[model samples]
Target: MLWPYQVKTVPSLPEDAVRLDVVEQRIVPPEEDVVLIAHRQRIVRGLRALFAAGVAALGLLVTIQVVMIVEDRSRVQPGLVMMAIFWLVALVVGYDAAKGMLKPLPRGKWSELVAVPASGLATLGCRIQWPDGRWSDALLSKVDPALAANVFGTQRLWIVGEAFRGATTFAGVPGHAVLGRVRFN
Candidate 1:
């Protein structure tokens, strides 16, 4: 049954009472979808800005280097440092861009959806879908399990589920992404 109260959770929806089919799951009062969209937009904007800044900084560094080379003959110390910093920043930004490109963006009103199959596994850990939704990474854990038996026998499935719910990890998680449900395959 659809509840009017639930419909209000999704910010994208109009204030009028409405029922939404979120992904494949049918939520009674639709779960709040506000933060996901806002967070996703924020991420996209941040990445775009970082990319622009990185490019601009790199260009400035190059210009300074060129002028220094032409005028002094010997390399300028400060210019070299600045250029190095610029390159480092650019490298970081480029990596971020790659990750953003590879990861799938949030789909529909349910931005937290992730499908991780059993086939993708790791030696030291397990494999999980990346938040951007493009790739999987090894899950480093305290107790490494070789077979599914261990996962199921110990009820560690919950842990696995929790991990799946969380966004593809870089280092840790943020408050907004903390809410997620795990699906077993």
Candidate 2:
């Protein structure tokens, strides 16, 4: 019954918390295929680069505004206000992007059950659970109906965030990582 976008407090489980290190040790074998690991690393790096570019663009805009304001004292009032707003937005976006970049992917077991319900035109609702008693309900778009029909309860998925924030893809496999048009509803 967990909705994807609903932010609910997850009560701590009574059992010992699963440490990231322990999970990593158990999941990633020493002799695991280096190619798959390299691919995952590349995905992470690409995401980081995208975030960096966003931050840089924001920074450049702020700098340009500052220069404009400095060059024109008569138009300082509006420019100053715009600069303040831009700076605030840039800081917020930069902070969030940085946090995402720093977060490590956690290993978790995907629940065997998956629910796919039609929401609207070109949209499907999906619910997936984790073995640790966590659930994610998401709205997906542009997904192949055949693939969607077949994928439920089929593969072990790698999750980037607790509430399925970043991306979800089949782990330990190439070309199955990217699901189409995923959005937390």
The runs of at least 3 residues in candidate 2 whose Cα sits more than 4 Å from the true structure, single-residue gaps closed, are: 1-39, 75-102, 108-111, 114-123, 127-149, 152-175, 179-185
Please give, for residues 16-104, the per-residue lDDT of candidate 1 as tens digits.
86996776634221123344445546666777787677777777777777788789977776756667686877768687645643354
Best by lDDT: 2
User: In model 2, what lDDT does residue 116 have?
Assistant: 47
What do the candidate models score in CA lDDT, each in turn?
Answer: 0.43, 0.49
TM-score for each of the candidates: 0.38, 0.43
> Number of the top candidate by TM-score?
2
Task: Kindly give the number of clashing pairs for every candidate.
Answer: 3, 0
User: How much is 91 displaced in model 1, in angstroms?
Assistant: 2.4
Candidate 2 per-residue lDDT, tens place, 1-185, comes to 11257576877855876655543323333124354445456667876787677667667766766777789866555754676577668767766645532444344432233444445424556665645666677665655443354444353323332444455433222223332334553
Q: Which stretches of candidate 1 lie over 4 Å from their true place?
A: 1-35, 75-82, 85-98, 101-103, 106-185
